[model samples]
Target: MNASFSSSSSSKGMMDHGDQPHVLAVDDNLIDRKIVEKLLKNSACKVTTAENGLRALEYLGLGDDQNNTSNVSGLKVNLIITDYCMPGMTGYELLKKIKESSVMKEVPVVIMSSENIPTRINKCLEEGAKMFMLKPIKQSDVKELRCQLMKYGS
Candidate 1:
């Protein structure tokens, strides 16, 4: 846990927790984003968020359809957490974009949503989502995130 980035619920909700590895969260809901932020705060991990997949790609300097730009500097995002449904691009679409991206294919993604449909779950897995957590943002989810950090921190 080193750096943290958060976007404000009301006004873009941007927070910079320094240069640590980041967990990019893409969720349109303010409360959900806040909960994730609080949970990761304890671990001191840097967090960045986007309301949609497009914005997330911009933050990472990725082009349309998840293509990465080699000119960008210091854009090393570790994990991504997104909600399934959104106004513009769905989480699955975002995941697809990430997977298609040149250098981002290896980045792990976690899908968090209220939808429990098997189709959605299977779709996320097919798109390479590393984990799926049903919402309303439980403490266990936080613990799981911590475990993931531990497992991948090396």
Candidate 2:
């Protein structure tokens, strides 16, 4: 699978929110990924995207290299928003990986899904997810997202 990475720098008409929060959004669906990228950018966030959990890990500088804290672009990721269900890795699994890693543990992670399974939500939260959002995320959700980023963006 070809994983595409996009950032606010590559887009047109994106506002320059100076020193804005940087977010990494991961999802398998193209439409869903685009929606996340657009919404975060609209909210004045510097957004980046990956098509899967593994690609997201790569972007987070957690690949074969031992220095997982160093991102490829050298951008400090403030928060991570990921889809709950995906082909290779579930959001819960991704959350666990992030929380386990010493370098990436401080970064906040949020999970999104169309399914509102209480068990799934609880599992994600237990695994260190900062928040769980329902699918078709709206503009109203951006406020909470901003809050999470601010709380952990340091």
Candidate 3:
């Protein structure tokens, strides 16, 4: 193949990959994290999994030494979807932090929980979370995130 042909193909590959939405998923459970990663992948979104809220905060550069963090992998994280009941920090706390962040406040957040508690759902929504979904998330549920992802222009 000629140089031009190879370059064109490479650009095509990048263009397709670059346009996909990048979503950070936080879950304490390994099985749940893997499930979320697979579901998000199937929905055509790039996924990054965090084991707990503190880890997720570190990834977002909101940890103890905020100045030294990577500032979210140098990628435009379009959405954050996290589990509500992680040990170190609950999803509600994470949502509050994100909303408080001047730079990241506008980014949409989705909280997930296995238990469908009304108070928890209401609190997450009132605190600026875009969605509060129950766990064992379906492909269709992940598919629904496309709209939230689209709102961010990812």
Against the reference, the lDDT scores of all candidates come to 0.73, 0.85, 0.80
Candidate 2 has what TM-score?
Answer: 0.89
Pick out the ten consecutive residues of candidate 3 with the lowest summed lDDT. 2-11
- Which candidate leads in TM-score? 2
Give the alpha carbon lDDT tens digit for every residue of 2-92 in model 2.
5358776435465554568889999999999988888887887888899899888888888667755678877788899999999988888
Q: 36-82, model 3: which lDDT tens digit per residue? A: 88888778777777888787777777778867534556766789999
The TM-score values for the models, in the order shown, are: 0.79, 0.89, 0.86
Better of 1 and 3 by lDDT: 3
* Clash count for each candidate, listed in order shown: 12, 0, 0
User: Rank order by lDDT, top first?
Assistant: 2, 3, 1
| lDDT at 53, model 1 | 71
